[model samples]
Target chain A: MAVSQRALEAAGLGGGRGRLERLRQWREQEHVFGYGLILPALVLLTCLVAYPFGMAIYFSLSDYWVGSPGQFVGLTNYREILGNDVFRQTVQNSFVFTGFALTLKTLLGVWLAVLLARDVRFKRVLRGAVLLPWVIPTALSTLGWWWMFDSLYSVVNWTAIRLGLISAPGPNWLGQTNYAMAAVIIVNVWRGLPFFAITVLAGLMSIPREFYEAAEVDGASSRQRFWHVTLPLLKPVLAVVILFSTIFTFSDFNIVQILTRGGPVNTTHLFATLAYQIGLQGGNLGQGAAISLFLFPMLAMVVFLQLRYIRRD
Target chain B: MASAASVRARRLRAALTYANLTPFVFFALFPFYFMFVTSFKRNAELYNLKAVPFWIQTGAITDHYDFLFRRTEFLIWMKNSLIVSVIAMSISLVIAILAGYSLARLRYRGVGSFGTAVFITYLVPPTLLFLPLSQVVNWLGLSDSIWALVVTYPTFLVPFSTWLLMGYFRTVPREVEECALVDGASRLQTLLRIVLPMAVPGVVCAALFGFTLCWNEFIYALTFVSQSGNKTAVVGVTADLIRGDIYYWGSLMAGAVLASVPIVVIYVWFLDYYVSGLTAGAVKG
Candidate 1:
């Protein structure tokens, strides 16, 4: 009974204690300190990300431009964008571009990661070399690609001709619709493949070697071992990587903007570049806001799925 | 006989693997190689149909480098990029260290949801936010200033740094902090004195990633800063180099090469941390 009473006093659970009151006060201070520590980050995030997100949605519904105040005009901007031919084409183009680029990146990333995980000679050098496209800024690297794909001075064409692969100058890459799309997608894959390879390689490294050893001892072939042990273990990491990459690829701006600038009859305009065109350049802020918001629903679905997966873990 | 056939098959498989890897390696490195080679090529060599495209002509000229330095605002852009990247990185590290420590160590309500919120914000790509963010920048009267990029970059950087740091902080043994607490150390002192020193690699990783991100930022820098002197390398190179119907290929290549050198050097120096930091966030998240 005495020990219980003393413990209560120490915790300030008993009324009107001296040192125990100071202890309670210190605990309260710590509680407030937690909030204080998070306050700056929270405030900054609200101003930069959260507030802008809300304004983007509001701007989508208003007739806001660069210089003029906007009037609320619900669904008008969305309807027009949905109905417009350029916007429609861009919507299709964004999907195609993201889909093809991501598919290729995933395949190549897995293959590269598998190779990298092996005990190859000069492995560190090879890994560093492979990551060059990713570490360099996309805009700068894409510029190099732009020069390489120049209609008249294309290096690719010169090499192809020398190798007897083509008899004539290569087609203008960014001047044609399909070729423009292909060029942008190619650059996107090149830059993005390293991300997948590195992340998947990390995933591959985390799997216990004993699992592979056990499988081999059970008479499993390399292919069978990969299917049974590696794929299942890699699924979680792959899910997270794919989800993140999809969101990124869908919102990609630099690659398209730098390479194609939504050129060749606007066949390469993703949501971002199209928004930049209409909002900033064309002075139609409301419409641009709406166009950018088109990505929101799709990405929100992805974020929701990702959150659920993370929570389950 | 079976063993010999299997050995031959393995050899063949190894050859095929190398064959598959060769093209990918070539594709990955070719653009950079082309950029370097073309940067040094004389304008005459660049235009000549008879010259080989892959190799630079003997006694290649540095006229493009001369042009980039003398005729363009390349140096000013480099300074601007350095200034903005450093400021943004410092601010991001400070905020992320506090926020990450709080989320990872402090006992508090709503930390789980708060951490998730930060992750979700990270997921909110800059593309969706840039339009409204531009308006906000205008409102702050920061457009056309390096401060615009310095302030805006933290939106992406803080969340990423915090997320990475949170993972790092979690890996730290909790008993160390508890012992400090028992020794009558405040949380702040403990974090600064004890935890931070132990977490140097994590902090360095965060700093490197954050700095590289700020250096690489494009769309905001492109949109917010239009003045020639204020533009960063990526934006300036794209805008000023390509005149309509006349691509200054050599100078553009030189500019690209110059812009990439600092980042490439950093990547080479910190390759392991770069790879692990990148993958740790994804795998952990």
Candidate 2:
């Protein structure tokens, strides 16, 4: 009887060990299959992103045009762009556009989120309506704005005249340096605010009601509660909004191209449109590449700082 | 006491509501209102330029629409855009879902950290790359072809699509897949029959994202497609605007309205999914 019972226990142990081995083999096979699954993405990225990056770095140093023979210029292209007044001004304009656009959008977005959070009539309609400009393609909408600002026949001019806001139809909006810049900035802010509002609304929703209740119970006014309670809670989303807006505004080409085409004597030029004009249109590939090379450092600094803030949040 | 408290709360809520919404309502809707009114006016009326049109002209003509369709290459551009967008969206969706599932569920050597790192590459600005890419396109002999856009768009699409799909795939329970494996199903079979159907929302979300990204693409489209007839709708629309002394404002607005229709419909249909998809991984900094 003892030998029979010992044999039974040995068989049970052997069967359990076999199942474990089988499971291990299955896991190994799954891992292999998993790698196979990711093979397409890996290959696509390597060819599309990685190769292009290496090529960009190489071309930045070479004097290459669309139809002309390429020659190695080696830092000359970079130096030329660095010294160029238009390039420097564009870099400055990008910062200005980003700074103003981000600040206005954030304030307006937060205010909108706060409004939407309260009970209001037609809230659903308002919510849907607010996202329209953002939903519309930037190219199409900016084109629409272009017609509105037509120097020959501007509706805004007509209206301002009718409303007695201005004495005459006024100067050519697209021709003037300052008004053109202001128009583009306004369009950027208008296009960007929906994203900000929706994102900030989501952020506001994540904050606990108890914080506001606590603040109110302590006899805090709405302003006090906002500064002390809402602002702190909303920091992470605000940071993200600003960061994304900065990146997008910095890289923006469509609106500027449609409206001004970096015109009014290049007063409204940004790095991206200028790069396109110099490189592709003017047929100076190296110079265009040089203008764009600053993209990496500028974007990296903003992304790095914002990412740190986000991580802390 | 309860009645007084309720009344006070109602009044406070009303005031709060007004305060929150006053700026955004005007901010969002004014441009749309302006566009609608502009589309209805005759050239003379449009040129007359008033603050707002006083009357809705039953005489709003479809002449601009006719001009856009017949006079310009608008139809062809639209057709090319549709063909390109559909193909790109379908490819990205399928590839992204498979890769996202693999990254989310399966363990491989160095896959975990590497997957997240791969996603960061999406944030790299295209401004730096387009010039060199133009050279690469020239070398490949693909300049002035729609096919060039097809090749390059996936660079942007795949990373975002994969990231979104990965986040989405994580929310699914593992037990569901285990059951499929236990039933003698291969991983592919399980992914097809069990994983995909369950992950339709995510797949749909990825498809929409891919579709929009390809649709709204400009820089590469502008750089690559050089021929006038070969231009995409985005490039084509701008090209159409310059016909020397005859700026077709009505047709342009009509085209603008037309271009946004498909996307607007998409938004209206699947807004909740679209919003969640766009904003999900976006906040991760």
Tens-place lDDT digits, model 1, residues B1-285 = 999999998888777777777888999999999999999988888888889889987668889999999999999999999999999999999999999988888877888888888989889889998999999999999989999999999999999999999989888898998899789876777889989988888899999999899999999999999899999988898888886657489899999999988899899999999888898777787
Q: Any runs in candidate 2 off by more than 4 Å, and if so which?
A: A1-30, A306-313, B1-16, B19-23, B49-58
User: Which model scores highest in lDDT?
Assistant: 1
Interface RMSD of 2: 2.2
lDDT of 1 by residue, A247-281 (tens): 99999999899888899899999999999999999
Cα deviation of B229, candidate 1, in Å: 0.6
The total number of steric clashes, by the backbone 3 Å criterion, in model 2 comes to 3
lDDT of 2 by residue, A160-272 (tens): 77789887867688889888888888889888888887778778878999999999999999999999999998887888777766777888888898899988878788888
lDDT of each: 0.90, 0.78
Distance from true position, residue A8, model 2, in Å?
39
Q: What DockQ does each listed candidate score? A: 0.67, 0.50
Q: Which stretches of model 1 miss by more than 4 angstroms?
A: A1-28, B1-16, B244-247
Among these predictions, the greatest TM-score belongs to: 1
